[model samples]
Target: MSILSDDIPALILIDIQKGFEDISSWGTERNNPEAEENARILLNLWRSKDFPIFHIQHCSSEPESLLNESNHGNDFKDIVSPLVGETIVKKNVNSAFIGTNLRKLLDTENISKVVIVGLTTDHCVSTTARMAGNYGYETYVVSDATATFDKVGVDGQLFSAQLMHETALASIHEEFGLVVSTKEIAQQIN
Candidate 1:
């Protein structure tokens, strides 16, 4: 069955920034080398279709964080940068709706379904997807358009980045939202 409806869904891109490129600084192995490229393709498709697009920028409150506004890493990746008129939601937390007016904006526009794609699949993207589902929006997470890094478990065991990414998606699927591929979403929207 198609996860997407006939009604067009708004595109919400979360935290696709230069900060994610600093692998050494992040101190972890990463997966999905083509995430950015896949995100770019979706962004271009959304723009071409004149769909509502929102760019979520993470402005970390911590001074040492790479996403701090004062750092160059806070800048959006060139390929998925918000255009002059597209809405840019600045957030300090994982969920874009927490401190931002994203929910209100969507409400005003009558946007009930959202197609999400972006950085770290486990963090911001997953948080947003969960919240979106709870808020009654039919949310779809594009798996290939998001990536994450290896993490140390509570027991101090390291997990592969790919495993973490897939697990994150699996955890959200059929509960928070549907996990689809970039190609699947592209076909649905196009």
Candidate 2:
């Protein structure tokens, strides 16, 4: 059940921004209200060990978008905000690696494994997980530490937030990374 080893895994948090607080802007409703708290748990662990931690902030292109660089919503949520000396990678697209130096930073640090936790499981979180796997990193997506909102399908049927969240994790699990809980990560490190 251990997801880690002698090599320390970098903690990659994707888009845990204040913009996500606006459910209307993102979707109908979001699943896992405790996502930030759970991420905070893992973040503290990483900080305790002085492991590599990357905070990926999404900078939306739309000027009116909540995640736009000039908006206060673009700032990281207080629960899991980065401290001094932490690596902060700002990206415009879904994947943190796209149009950012995330890959280069990982390569420079010689990090072979990554533990990802953040907002919108079906979007940025999923995209980053997929890319991390493709990049040959041993990726682990924390299930309880990432979430998504309900969406209307093409047929106009409403999909539940919980359903969307679970499905996103499913797609990432095995293929992209191992979907685990915050507890699983803590157990491994402890």
Candidate 3:
């Protein structure tokens, strides 16, 4: 099947917030420095095409969390800020489908396909993509438009950010959805 079919898919951007800039505090190396740039490209494409777009904001409840609403870091990155009339879904959890009416809005609009992009590939992005698939949406995850940080495993082995990012994509590639790039999705749209 085509990455995008005749039905136009909604672009769901997850947690593209300024909090991610606190790399020092995150305590991990990161990959895909150009992820937000790629995400911007996709967002522009979606806007230019007049397609549906959903912005998922991660509002942390913890006072110490950078993503807490009171913190400046909780604001959406300027590059991917939501335009008027675009849907903004505030989520406290990993999956956008949870604690938000994202699924309901999609179903109401009859949006059967979704193009997802965002921060921390291994966390929120992966969880949302899995739920999107299980919820029966034809999901496409833009690899270059998302990124993750290096992590130390339970065995105390450190994994590179690139490795974790690719592994996360691979885990969901066939069963959950297709893992693609911004350029590829743009081509399909054209």
Which candidate ranks first by TM-score, i.e. highest?
A: 2
Cα displacement (angstroms), candidate 3, residue 84, comes to 1.6
Global lDDT for candidate 2?
0.93
Give a tens-digit lDDT track for model 2, residues 42-96. 9999999998999999999999999999999999999999998899999999999
C-alpha positional error of residue 30 in candidate 3 after TM-score superposition, expressed in Å: 0.7
Residues 16-115, model 1: lDDT tens digits: 9999899877647899999989999999998999999999999999888899999989999998988999999999999999999999999999998898
TM-score for each model: 0.96, 0.98, 0.97
Q: Please report the candidate that would top lDDT against the real structure.
A: 2
Off by over 4 Å in 3: none
lDDT, model 3: 0.93
Q: How much is 33 displaced in model 3, in angstroms?
A: 0.6
lDDT, candidates in the order shown: 0.91, 0.93, 0.93
Q: Which residue segments of model 2 deviate by more than 4 Å?
A: none
Query: What ranking of all candidate models by lDDT puts the best one first?
Result: 2, 3, 1
User: Model 1 — which ten-residue stretch has the worst lDDT?
Assistant: 1-10
Tell me how far the alpha carbon of residue 134 in candidate 1 is from the true structure, in angstroms, after superposition.
Answer: 0.4
